[model samples]
Target: MSIESPRTAIVGLGITEMGKVFGRSAVDFAVEAITSAVADAGLDLSEVDGLYVNPGIKNDTDMRLQSTLGMRDTRVLATVQGFGSSAGQMVQYASMAIEAGMADVVVCVYADAPLQEGKRAGAAYPGQARAMVGVGSLPFAAGLKAAPERYAVAARRHMHAYGTTSEQLGAVAVAAREWAVMNPHAQMREPMTLEDHQSSRMIADPLRLLDCCLVSNGAVAVVVTSAERAATLRQPPVHVWGWGQAHPGYVNRRGSEFGLVTGAAQSGPAALKMAGVSVDEIDVREIYDCFTYTTLVTLEDYGFCAKGEGGEFVASGAIAPGGSHPTNTGGGELSSYYMWGMTPLSEAIIQARGQAGERQVDRHDLVMVSGNGGVLDFHSTLILSAHPKGR
Candidate 1:
């Protein structure tokens, strides 16, 4: 479906105090974000007919939140989960529902409270060995009971195949840190350099502590409605031009295409095709940076650069603030908050609405947002614009 006027738009956005804030459950953040987003959209809870909720590491669910928020009589209500990909999937489903007349207004939210007072961030995600009790996975048998180790292997495979270097991955980290300094809410805002990235202690072989995303406690939510309905409401509408998803299951070893290629290849093309735009048309990009390598490989997968050339593409500081490719303008999950895909989704909206403050790009016409889940297994892409457009 394509039209000159966008059929659906995001009318409201709410983000709680992300990062290490303590003493609040994921449910608390969910209600806070949902209510605030509704208010931002100039709507009442009673008028909202649809709701989408995705839990985080803490496992807060839609059922718990609906009751906590006193939401009832909704036409569409369900749990959306594809790990990190849920954020984009929720918007895609909400848009489809609104177009089909299933519901008028839908709110999608994700919240997690994994940080406890005095506990280290690593404690939030314990060893995966317990989770692999019943299974005899190759990774588990090899004592790869943690995420960083698994990802390190993937990074190693990419490096071995294409001769990617640490400094190249460090470039992505430096760029994200550069963007973080501009965002007030980012967790790690200190100025960083390739040297700093190299100096940071290694979590697993090629991956350093700086390369991984920060663990945080917070929530991010958005309200979606028809463009016509949005124009009659509060804040300017962020048009939903197009969206797409791909889930390429990961194999534990280097024998498969797991580390080299990701879902961005298919999903990016699909989303851009639906949005009626090209790579060059995107003025800003908010990519999920669960890890620095994730950002680099994803850039290559999205056609921003050729496969196996992500290292050279990012080493030029192009993805930084004063460069050709503006990416992760809100600091991204690497240095910014990590609320799954919401980190990128929230920033995408902020940029699309021209509310990024110092980090705002002059050209805010088109923004590309990506979501990745698992070990680069699940992926989803969204193309957004400030002006209404056909899908």
Candidate 2:
């Protein structure tokens, strides 16, 4: 099924306080976010009949949330298990359900409290050891590697092919911090210069400590309903113009066709095509910034610039606040508290609605949001607009 026209819209958004320690369970945060979203939409919980959640925490299933929240009318329940890449998928599924008449009001949510449990966030995955090697199966070597090392391999390729520099990568980190300084909920608000980014300790070669996203504790929720219904809500409706998802398979291991993972190359065009808008029309961008290189590669793949030109493009400060194309005004995952990619999505919605306070941009009509998951294995994109379809 294709969404040629904007039929569903995001009517409400809510986020829990972000910090090192939330001192609560994932469900508690999810409930809090959902309650805020429902109230923000000027609707009661009883009116919600659908739920879409990213199952980050163990045993955090849709049924568990439904039972806990007493959402008796929930007719559609789906758990997108895309890890950091699941945020856009959650919104996509909710919009699909609402468009299909399976539900009227669908609430999409994500939550985690890794710090409070004394556990390192994103460290639970046991790579490669669980994979069954066979013909056409991913090699055992693929399983032996983790995210930082895998992304480093790609970064090295970009440097070799395009003469990209660590300073160019540092530009992304600095820009993220520049925006974070204005975000009260941001975890790292200290002024960060390209020099500071370069000085940070190296986690993986070519990828410094400042290049990575924060391990944060937080939750986010968004309410999706028909555009007609959303028009009657309390807040301005952010129309879902288009969305697309792509899985490019594992690109870190040996004998891969692409060598460098570029799933956004496929997903971005699909979304833009569906939205019937060119890249030039996008006023704001919230690309996934799991690392600095992630943003660089995505920019090229998304047709923002020519291939191998991302380094120079970002170095021009075009993505920084007040630049021609403002990106991640909410600080993104790099400087802001990382609730996976939900932070970026929330920022996109805020921009679309003209609700972003200090970081608000002038042209708030069209916004592009992207998400990446599992070592660049999966990618998703969404185009949100301030106006409804055919307006």
Candidate 3:
């Protein structure tokens, strides 16, 4: 059965300080974010009846947060697992709970204390030898070993197929850093150029150090409630018009079709269709940017440009501030704090609420936010608006 459209709105947003070391546990960050969000929503912690969390690098669970935060009425507690792509799904769970009358207000949260955890924070996949054997004759053995290696193969393939240049990939990194300079919360605020991106150490072939997302320690939380309830809150409601999720299966199983496309091809259109809007109506785009190629391919998959034409689309600076399409205004994961996809979702909400300060877009009425999980295996898309539907 098809799930009903989300009728909820994000009435509050909160984020803890992001950096290399917070000297605090993940639960501490989660509590701080939830408290801030509750206050921002003009509600007491006791009013929260639902909780959604994606504890990446954190050992905490939903019950722990509910107890620590004093959410005595929390009726719906869920933890979604999609690796980095779990943030958007958290919102989906909250919306579903609210729609079903299981809860009145829901808080979606994510927290990570990677820096404080030291070497344990940077754990690599174990049993690579056995994994390679499982792949059998598939050539993806090496790429499957790590994220960078997988994306590098995709970048190389895109270059060979469409003549996409390394400079084009560098343009994506440069544009993100450009936005970063304006974002105080961005971890890497220093101005970066295409030359700087090209000169950075190569992590995996075409993917450079600057092209990858940051290793950050932080927490983000957003309060979700029905539109009717949000109107009485202190903050403006960023209405959730539409949302869609898709999985393209595993890369190793998909074979040749694996890296050639992303799940956004399905999720993006589904969200727009559900919202009764087209791509051109979107005023802001907050797509996941785990890597430069991730952004490039996602743009193409979202129908922002033709297939294999993402390089030219971004190279034209269309995604920069004041451009035709303002994307990842908070510098995205590339320059912003990498709390999975929470960084982009938070930026989208801020822009939709007209609270983006200097980086705010001229037209902030509509926004399209996308998230990627696994090795381009899972995707989620959301369409948000400044005003609720029919308002």
Rank order (by lDDT, best first): 1, 3, 2
CA error at residue 72 for candidate 3, angstroms: 2.3
Q: Model 3 over residues 128-192: C-alpha lDDT tens digits?
A: 33434554736555445657787788788888888888889888888888888888888988888
lDDT of 1 by residue, 147-250 (tens): 77877888998999888999998998889988999999888888988888899999989999888889999999999999899999988899999888999776
Candidate 3 residue runs with Cα over 4 Å from true position: 1-5, 58-63, 117-144, 250-255
| TM-score attained by model 1 | 0.96
Q: Estimate the overall C-alpha local distance difference test score of candidate 1.
A: 0.88
- For model 1, state the Cα shift of residue 305 in Å: 0.8
Model 2, residue 186: what's the lDDT? 87
Best candidate, TM-score-wise? 1
Q: Write down the RMSD of all candidates, one decimal each.
A: 1.9, 2.6, 2.7
The estimated TM-scores of all candidates read 0.96, 0.92, 0.93
Error of 1 at 363 (Å): 0.5
Q: Which is better, 1 or 2, measured by lDDT? A: 1
After superposing all C-alphas onto the true structure, candidate 1 shows an RMSD in angstroms of: 1.9
